[model samples]
Target: MADIIIKNVYVLTMDSYELTQGVVVIENGTITEVAESTEQDADQIIDAKGSVVMPGFVNTHTHAAMTLFRGYADDIPLDEWLKNYIWPAEEHLTDEDAYIGTKLACLEMIKSGTTSFADMYIHMNDVAQAVKDSGMRAALSYGLIDLGENRSADVELSKGKQFVLDWKGEAEGRIITMYGPHAPYTCSEGFLSKVKKEANHDRVGIHIHVLETESELNQMKQQYGMCSINLLDRLGFLGPDVLAAHCVWLSDDDIEILRGRGVHVSHNPVSNMKLASGVAPVPRMLDRGVNVSLGTDGCASNNNNLDMFEEMKTAALLHKVESLDPTVLPARQVLEMATTSGARALGIKSGVLREGYNADVIIVDMNKPHLTPVYDIHSHLVYSASGSDVSTTIVDGRILMQDYEVVCMDEQDVLDRARTAASGLVERAKF
Candidate 1:
């Protein structure tokens, strides 16, 4: 007997053009079978007749606890938004606030078919706990910064290292740990180099922001007499273990550096557009064979949502318009960016539905009026389908949501706690 079996659904393995009527069998948190028919019985069987089963989305970059700051500061530049409002507001957040905020984020992501994510923020222990309790997979890191603040570089790096060591493979191997140095402008060169060394020493990955805005590019040139890419490269900090977010203001040379170093890029189109950060050259990066993945930075900068479906649609449309070519990012490629590319960025095995793979999957209901005529499944998924279309989300062979009902966590309780937390945060921040 298997642990669970899902039958009567169209399986989009994402490994190949294997979209067909099939049944998927799960056992021991892994996919045991995916084929036309399974002769196996399961303790729990799900008959998903009118849905398409595929890999769940992996968010490559996010500040999960920032869910508390969603809609709190909107329609502002990245610098002003962060320095004036967001940073000030963050000072008032308690551990309980971070916990509730992350729980809310996990609830939203699970409901929207996101089974895993990469999160960097303060109070990351609380964030990790929330992810564990919510039954989601995550790569977590403590946001590190050392720019003349009261916290010294050693202290900050020590804290980040503690986080990495404490949660390297926690949550039954569902949580991976990384060292998150906030960004180039925020952290000094010495600090970044130290962080890279620590990450390499621990054999973990490093997540950081790189040139999200023109201002950062300008600041780097002024301060270091070079671009952020060149400075980081000079420090030997660029590598496959680096997850760089928002390469919006990159030059051709910078893109080459990233590709040469085999660094992963997490393109947050929604957050970039919202913050007026320049658009990243995704087509150029893809054309150069760089592994460009998709991410919804955080709720605060992305219309207060973690819906990867919206992220997919926005990425497809944004790149096309920016390049003045409607055929730039096709539906299938955008879907890959959201699923396969993101998984690769996080070094996870959940992006493709295959035997012996992690059972991080979602069933999208295509029977809606909007998705009435299924001319092309890929097209419908990338261009037409929304997060609400997801009827089930399974992570590690566990049914987090089934038939539009969330089973892993209390949905209403999370929402209520989130509201209370947000209210208290507002009072504390006085904004």
Candidate 2:
């Protein structure tokens, strides 16, 4: 007997082009079968007659707790936004703030069909705890910075290392920890090297922001006479294990270096556009055989929400207009970036709806008027579909949201607490 079976649905396995009507069987937190018909009995069976069953999205990069800062500070340059507003406001965020904020983020993601994400931020224990309670998978890290005289490099690294060791494989293997060395401009070479060494020793990955803006690129050139990519490559920090977010200022040489180093790039088109940061060379990188994934950077200040569907649509449209080629980033490819490429970046087995893979799946309702007359599934999914179209979300064979009703956590409580926390933070920050 299977644990759960979803029948009479258009199954998009995402491993190939074939989208067929089939039944998916889930058991033991893994996909057991995907076929035209199943004779298996299950504990709970969903008759999704007018839905598309596909892999849940993986957000490769985000600051989850930054949900509290949504709309707090906007319309400012990246440096000014961070220094004058975001950084100052962050000092007032407490553990409860982080927990409630992350809980709110998890609630939003679950409703929007994202099963997992990679988050780098402060108050990560509270963040991890929130993830655990939300029943979502995550690659989490404590954001590390070592530039200012008041901050000790050793202490930051020690805290990061302890968090990695303490939470790795926790929450029934839903939580994967990494070393987050904030960014190139903020951390010195020696600190990045140390982080790389420690991450290698612990056999975990490194998540860092790389060249999100021209300002960072210029700063690196002024300080080290090289670009951020070259500097990090010299430090031996670029590799397959490195999930570098926002490679917006890359030249051709920098792209080649990233490709050669096997670094996975998280293209945060929404955040970059919101910040007025330059666009990344996603088309060039994909052509060079580099793995590019999708991400909606923190909601509070940049993206304003963790909607992978919006990110997918924005990515498809943004690359098309920027390159002046309508054929650049098509709907299907952008969908892959949000799914398989994202899972590949985080080294998770939850992107494809296949046998022996993690059962992180979502059911998108196609019965709506907007989604009707779907001649092409990919076109409608990428161009017309929104997060509100997701009717069901499942992670690890467990249902988080079924028919728009969230069961893992209390929706109203999370929203209320999040509002209260945001209010208190504003009062404290006085910005």
Candidate 3:
């Protein structure tokens, strides 16, 4: 008998630029078949009942451990937000706190139909372990911010090597590790070069914040005498494997540099807008052939929910409002950025529905009023459907969320931990 069969679903394969009605067969932790004719039997079957079954979203940028600090310090410039509140609070974050925070992040991700994410955070082993326990797929980065002399870059690099050694391919290959050099302003050239050296050996990708603020842009221009993207390019930062977050305030030459190097950009509109950071030149970047993906950045800035659908809508509309062109970043491209493009950025396999791919899928309740009279599934997904409409989330052929309920973890317990952690973080912040 087949392992799992999903029947009567409107499958938006996200493959070959099309969507259709079909049944999917999953077995051995991989998608075994996709056929319109549900003329088969299985050990288990889900009657999707006309829901939109599509690939699970991939969050290419997130500070998973920072979910503990969500809404603790909002309504500030990006620089001040980091320096005044976030950095100070992060100092007090222990491994237990990271575990607790990341567990909450994973739960939120599951509830919102995100199956995979690229996460940068401290106490990363805790975050990685949380992913392991939750059965969520993630790329865990040990956020290397060595501003203090006592705790140097060497220490962070050593810890990164240890992460690679210990957890690189763990959790049945669900967890991957990356070298995170927080941002250009936070990392010196010498330090980032060392990170590159380590990353080259490991052949893993590097995650960095690029031009999230005008001040950061000015700082890079004055200090390095180069634009942030060009500075990174000079430092050997851009490549096939690099995933740069934010990327606001980019110049034409910067877009050219990214496109030339085939660097992937993680567009986080929610975080950018929340911090009053200006919109990145996404249209220009796309025109220059840059691989752009969508991310929630983190719960602290976006505030508790890593829904790629919302991100997509924000991205599609943000440009129109700024550029005064409604034609920019249409629904089709937005969905691709969230799904297939995001998977490309993180080097994961299953962004589309097909045989032999990892079974990372989500079923959206298309029967809802918001999604009714679906002219185009892509349009409905991007412009209408909310994260709550996601009825099921499956990763590696394992059903994590089913019928609007998370199956693997206690949802209430996860919420309680987050509530406690948030209160504790606030208490400790009163200094």
Q: Clash totals for all models, in order?
A: 0, 2, 0
Question: For model 3, what is the alpha-carbon lDDT of residue 241?
Answer: 78
Could you tell me every candidate's TM-score relative to the true structure? 0.99, 0.99, 0.97
* lDDT of the candidates, in the order given: 0.93, 0.94, 0.87
Q: Residue 201 of model 2: what lDDT?
A: 99
Model 1 sits at a Cα RMSD from the real structure of: 1.0
lDDT of 1 by residue, 16-61 (tens): 7675689989999999999999889999999988889999999999
Worst 10 residues of 1 by lDDT: 147-156
Give a tens-digit lDDT track for model 2, residues 1-431: 89999999999888864556899999999999989999999999999998999999999999999998988777988899999889988999999999999999999999999999999999999999999999999999999999943358889999999999999999999999999999998888889999999999999999999999998998899999999999999888899999999999999999999999999999999999999998999999999999999999999655698999999999999999998999999988999999999999999998998999999999999999999998988889899999999999999989999989999999999999999998999888887
In terms of lDDT, model 2 sits at: 0.94
Best by lDDT: 2
Q: Point out the worst 10-residue segment of candidate 2 by lDDT.
A: 12-21
| Span of ten consecutive residues with least summed lDDT in model 3 | 145-154
**What's the true lDDT of residue 373 in model 3?**
90
